[model samples]
Target: MSVGTTQTRQGLGSRLAALSRIVELGPGRVDPKLLTESGQLLLRAGDRLKLSADHTVVALAGGTGSGKSTLFNSISGLELSPTGVRRPTTARAHACVWGLDGAGPLLDWLQIQWRHRFARASALDKGESRLHGLILLDLPDHDSIRALTDTEADRLIQVADLVVWVLDPQKYADASTHRRYVTELAGHEAVTIFVLNQADRLSPEELAECVADLNDLLRREGVEDPVIVTTSATTGEGVDELKTVLADTVARRRAAVQRLEADLDRLTLRLAKAMPDSGAPVPLSSIDDARRIGLTDALCDAVGVPAVGEAMENVYGVRSVEWVGWPYSRWAAKLRPDPLNSLRLGDLRDEIKGLTGGSVSAQAAEVDTAVRALSDGLTVGMHEAWQNGIRDAARSRSAELPQLLSDELSEVAPRLDRVPGWWRLLLVWQYLLVLLFLAGVAWLGTALAYGVFGAGSLPAGLAVFGEAASLPWVGLMVLSVLGLGLLTAVASRNFVMLGAGNERDRLEREMRRRVGTVASAMVIEPVERELARYNEFYSALRGVRG
Candidate 1:
């Protein structure tokens, strides 16, 4: 073989390796039939390559009454394959081997029995040695009345190293033959040959026209640079030229590999046609911030995050009032319900521990909507099979979603119970103001009782001042004390509520962060994994085509 041809075969070997990778990665995302057929072809090609690179199995395939058997006998120089006036003479495949060495395994692989096998070369037949190592097969007629013959012909045609289509003048332009077999096998031009049998039946002028017309049809059908040989099987015209073609093909010992390369090309083309025409997908290793936020928000809706955050705020505000409100009126704050208790969030550790089969506060419809939205966005412009495969991947972890979300809620629960250290300080200060007010009230009441009843003089410490001045100063002191206490209470209310609002914001942030983790594990990671698989499959298919 030439260096260029050797390089081509090496390239084909790489392509076969790529095809094998594709089969490994293409279960759910590809048609099962395509995968099965591709896998079988690869196995068959590997087996053939390992058997005998020295022997080239060339199958002569044609429709009924195409003189295919006559050409086979003429080339073999023996009547191994029967010829008759019957409509379908070649009912079964017959193999003619030029050299018998190492041909047993190949014939066995081809499923040709011993009765149908013939050897053309021997010590006495030196002239036939030129075509040594050639295994010629006369396949059953493709258009025979029996379905078995058609199936057998197709089966042999696919596995043959080279296929020489026998076409006679009367049926050369048969539309069914061209459409069903000739055009469909367009990629195998390297391992294909055409024989115009019974060419002597037409005049020379007619023969030239027939050849030209056939060439034109082949070109229109996308068969490029095809090799055609003219021969009259009955008269033995051009039989030597056919032998020369066979000898040259067998000499190179590259037909088998070339045939496999063309097979890969055809299979990859089918894959390419079945795939979406969309451009290369944008690589996504992880979810972007926008998508992350969207997912988090959706999950929050599904799990009632807003309601929980509001409840935390209400609980904070209620507890703040009970701790720091006007001491005498703080009793009223205790009458209100604890929002956290109502939501079963007051003791989340116990709740989680007791959960045997408890679900999260997630809504089924909302979760479905969120997951569908995510899958749809990720799989835009993909093929339906691919889209379904990715969607299924995204939901692969769905059965664990309830438990995962429950864990998130449990994780964020302790944070809600946390109270600021400053709240205690404010509580102490409020009580101090109340104490001063009560002491002032008691002193004013004692002086007023003594002055109004005139039962006794003021206490000794107060004797230095006149009665009017003492009474007025004591009343003013009481009023001033009460005013200060009232002012303190009013001012502290805003600060307490502000603290409560901050706690609400913190709770919401923590919950969102936890929910984001669940979203990633439950949806984003699996979807990205499937997309990566698809990209790998696509790349491998491209390698196969190359």
Candidate 2:
């Protein structure tokens, strides 16, 4: 599709509006300060567009002594400005609208109170319709005495779809002009024309040399292919060529948008580079397992139930059996509640809460610290593994792999605290209770009945009950108590192993999560941030180019 048709159909004003909304959504996403300045400049320029079905505005701009007004007069075939040998000739901007019905809206949009309209002299020589809606602006020098004049020139330069930058032979290589304006506007260089005006003053050789020099300078300034036209208002050299270029530019409506889109694309590419690659899965390790097991073991200890079953039975073995044999055993069991069987996960959770501190924030901090440590350790381990793998792989390639691995491991290792003493105590208690309860059950049954269901009198039953009640004389009772103690010691050892195993598994999971978080923060987040920064920088660079 033709550029003009696309631009006419898809309003630049609407695009600017959408961009404004996007900027609002993430104020800091694109560097609000830079975006704000850029947006303001772009929107202001967009607002000044003199929309027409068939016309394009081309504006000329430059610093004082750049001969912009002289160029304007040469192109329009009319004396548009009062020119002199003085540095600042035009104080106010002048517009020459050709073959347009009225200049009311156009002039109003440009904020121009003075305008001159012209038509071709004859039908046969009619270039009027071809130049229909064309408004040629002779703006005041951008480096003018009046700040407002310079401001207006800048605004016009931004608004004009095509810009003709008039440069004198001497000032063409001005550092301020090149650095502050030319280099910055790399993105918009396509829509820009760098004309070395006052070319008639230079000798043929000097003119050629000057043009070559300027072209080389522009290339260095990042204008890949800049058009350098030599012109003189005195001789009108290259005037016709300049006119033809302008007319063609006007005909191709897509030029401006295409230039702008290219600039945006360049910025997008830079942004993509700044973004980090999403590869490599976060790894899991054993240290994380240890921390989790330690925490759980600590929790079990705090709940006073590392060996809950044995502890409960040891503490109330006789009572438990009496209650079990009673006619109301079912109700007794429900009311009294065996501590081990009646154990609530909530209670254990609460104990964990207490150990970590009752506050969610506190627990979160503890968990975070523990998890972070584990993650760091895993990262270190992974780095070491990578180093070893690299060395093994590069045995056929290089010798620096081991050193690289060491460096990587050092980078990843996390600072760790010694396991808390309470954790060990908890593990010990957990085992002791389990053994005590198990032994108590065995001892109680043996001590209470020698054989299963033997013929017995009330005296015999009373004797058995009496003996069960006595702690010293009854052999079964003495043995059961001794067994309970022994079981406590034995069970405590097993509970420690079980607690360690459980903690290790939990820690492994926690460590994996921590590793993932670290990877996201260290790798992914930095990339995203860099991408955003580059995008904004590119946008600004492109804006200057234009």
Candidate 3:
């Protein structure tokens, strides 16, 4: 092969590779039937490329009584394909292979019977040298009585590198021929040729008119500048012209590649039509600020964020009372129920499972609605297949969501568990005040008992000036201690209430952050990745189209 030919082959190989990538990524985003057909074409093209680039397969197809077999023999210089006027003369396809050394695999790929295959290359025949490297197939008549023959003809026409439609004067304008083959194969003009066989039956002017009519018909069927050659098998008229066309096609060795390229072009266009109108990718923020906030709030509600924060506040209040409340009333704090344990928030995995699997929580339903809303927002104006694909991506990890959320909350739970050091110091201060109150009670009891059961005056040792003034002073000390203890308890209650409120706010913020992470992993990120895949598939499809 020349450098230009090698380069062309390389370019075709790259396009095929891109097409393969599209097929691999197209399962949910493209039509399944279209993808399946494209995949089959790729495999067929690969097998054809590997088998033979040196030889070209040209098939002659026509209706019954069109002299298709006679034209096949005239071009091959051998009576290889049988010719007869029987209703269904040729039952099977015949191959007159010029270079048969490496054509067995290709003919097998074409599904040609081995008995119908014949060799044309001979050193003694110089005239046959020009046709070397050509595999000429004489297909069964398409309008034959037997349906099987028509099927064989259609199959061979598709597999052949180039097709020569042999049209006699009688069936040149056959409706079935035009509808079934010519119109359908319109885009294959690059690798197609038309031959008006049995031209000896028509006068020179009549033949010209027939050829012009056929050209007009083909052009109407979207075949531009149709190559129609007039020929006669008995007189060998215009046979050389058809031979020259075949020889040149064989020499270029590009018919097979070109045929495959045409197939790719047709398939890619079909696939492209199934794609979404917009090719731009959706970003992560496709879930806009309002949508993000909505999703987060829904997720928070589903995971019981408000419940958890409220529980944290209540727990803080109970714990504060245990540490800083008056020692006499500390037991009452333990009687109040622990808010965290009531909601099963401590066992987050179980809570997550309940939220996701059970239908009782209205908040879980809100979560579902929010997630679906996000998917719908991103998939607007997309093809049905693509919309379904992106929606699937958004929920791809839905089963793992419960566990993921559980993990996140578990991490934040530790932060809420930490106890502040200042609470212990306040507990010490309360104990000191209790001790002072106890001492005052003891001193007053002594003064009261001495004044009631013993002498009328107080004891000198306990007196302030060894006189009755000690009685008033002792009573004053008791009142001061009682007032101070009440004031400290009041201050501690106020401090605990303030701290609990602050802790509730902190817990809420942290829970929102964790819920957001789970939302992103479970819904947002997957949707974004799917959009990215769509863009890749679109770019690869363009490469295949070229």
Top model number, lDDT: 1
TM-score of 1: 0.85
Worst 10-residue lDDT window for candidate 2 reads 355-364
* Residue 105 lDDT in candidate 1: 98
Error of 3 at 101 (Å): 3.7
Q: Comparing 1 and 3 by TM-score, which wins?
A: 1
Against the hidden true structure, what lDDT does model 2 obtain? 0.53
Better of 1 and 2 by TM-score: 1
Clashes of 1: 0
lDDT by residue for model 1 (254-284), tens: 8998899888888888999988447635464
Model 3 lDDT per residue over 1-546, tens place: 668767877888989999899989888677789889878888888888888888899999998888888888877778878877666678899998887788898889888899988887752355487777898898888887785534888777877899999888988999999999888777888899998988999999999889888889899988887888888988999998888898999988889888888777777777777774575445533555776787788778776777666655655665566776777677654565643343445655344333333212224455666677778887777777778888888778776675666666655653444467887887788788778778767766665666544545545665533333456776787677667766777788788778778876886798788788778778877787787777678778778876
lDDT of 3: 0.77
RMSD (CA, Å), candidate 1 to true, equals 4.9
The weakest ten consecutive residues by lDDT in model 3 span 353-362
lDDT of each: 0.80, 0.53, 0.77
Clashes of each: 0, 21, 0
